[model samples]
Target: MASKIFHPIFFILLIFIPLAPIGHAKRSSPSDKNSSPFNFIKKLKGCQKGNSTKDIHELKAYLEKFGYFSYENNAHAMDDDFDDTLESAIKTYQKNYNIKPSGIVDDETISKTTTPRCGVPDIANSINYMQPRDNNHESSSSNIHTVSHYSFFPRSPKWPSSKTYLTYRFISNVPTYARAPVARAFQKWYSVTQFSFEQVPTNQNSDLVIGFYRRDHRDGFPFDGPGGVLAHSFAPTNGRFHYDAEERWSVGSVPGSYDLETLALHEIGHLLGLEHSRVNEAIMFPTFSAGQVKNLHPDDIQGIRALYNQ
Candidate 1:
């Protein structure tokens, strides 16, 4: 309703969740088996101003994983140093997520980073890190990621045209309030494409199953708890959409709460076979504000249409 405000605490609740890599379950950071990957975010909060620690190195790796920080010899970049470039990248990341650009890794920063999210990254470089386009129209730019319009998947996968209507079911304990928010996301996609979503019974082998999950919920990418990733969906026809049950989810533009509907729009783009945009204003852009109201931007609409030929 009102223009969403950005208080320090306003964004602390919004975590930057990453896309879970689709494959056999992957290994987490080299921590004790009993520890959560999210612990790295918490430990990062302890790094003092103008200092470096093991946790800071891990934080750099985490940011690099999503196309944030990079060095030519990244092999040794994680050797525990909170240098100027790393701090700049961290500040850029904070600014992107609507967090104050404090540059120092504080409890507030780690608090947001600790949440589990979709396995997908905000930047879709070379289509799945190393996978490239057939034509080679795009070249690698600076380490910083930006919107490259009308992007496709690593292999550019999509659903067949004949099968237009996709069945989506709510699995696990999706609350009553969550229904409309989730439905609105589906409606937004439907408006832009020939695709329509049908809600079916849970665990009924539908095309898409929407639900909340906790740590190590089978698909290799484990949930790291409340501050890291928000939700992730599989590439088309796989039909698996999962949200982190641990997040403080809210339906609308509420401070200190995740706008699930906005996230749904982003994840659904991934489901329909689109990649992250280089255009920051596009919905597919990697980072999103916690309290902002967003519709599909013109660039986002263009990207989707380009993929589906709508």
Candidate 2:
């Protein structure tokens, strides 16, 4: 190898010239209120199949992260091309969120994309629980065919029949004030379901556990700071529910702050083995906006009943 030395003039020129960015620009994390991961999606609004841009790569990654992209499209995830797979994924996402499913990134789609939501994948194990389906398998009291949007985790796993009285404990990091809202959330579930719940000591082993975490906390799913993923929970028997500690959580109807009790209610539903629901009114819905509050819908009630054969 040969080594070359720059002249004094070259050094002077280097000082005067501006250097281009080394690689891609630093992307803002979800918690960044000014710019979120979905900002790229906003730039992609009106884009469809055959249109290509560097921003499409980010959109593909977002879809893949939420289980919208298929395995066969993995090779193209990093590419900027918007192909058939990308279009199909968008359509599925549109359908799941009750949009027109035109397969184009439209204003409505972009609006939904920007909202804060749960960390649970809308599609799990290749199953899209958000897809609308008929409730024919279950023995319903009515003869009319009913459309169901609520779903359960794969295999519909639930607490053992012998374990209806489940106990839960809040980890040490959970604040004292947050405990009341969480307890009320459990009471909401107990009001409708046959199962009962009791609180246990944090050190004692309990049927379920709850805590607040920020960023990557060793769990496979990490909290996305203040604005992105608000919380996530594991499926039945593996009762782990977590909240993003960085979020502005409130028990009252405060603007710009997420109601802790509302989110806790949703996570508790997931703790009971329910997956994301297509019904926007249901607590199992994947997305939740700040300052919004919701209770269990009929779909949620029917889902829990069907899962436990209550």
Best by lDDT: 2
Model 2's number of clashes is 0
Error of 2 at 124 (Å): 1.1
Write candidate 1's Cα lDDT for 255-293 as tens digits: 545677888888888888876654556677654544555
Would you estimate the TM-scores of all the predictions?
A: 0.65, 0.85
Error of 2 at 142 (Å): 9.4
Each model's backbone clash number: 27, 0
Least lDDT summed over 10 consecutive residues: which range in candidate 1? Answer: 3-12
lDDT of 1: 0.65
Superposed on all Cα atoms, the candidates' RMSDs to the truth, in angstroms, are: 11.4, 16.9
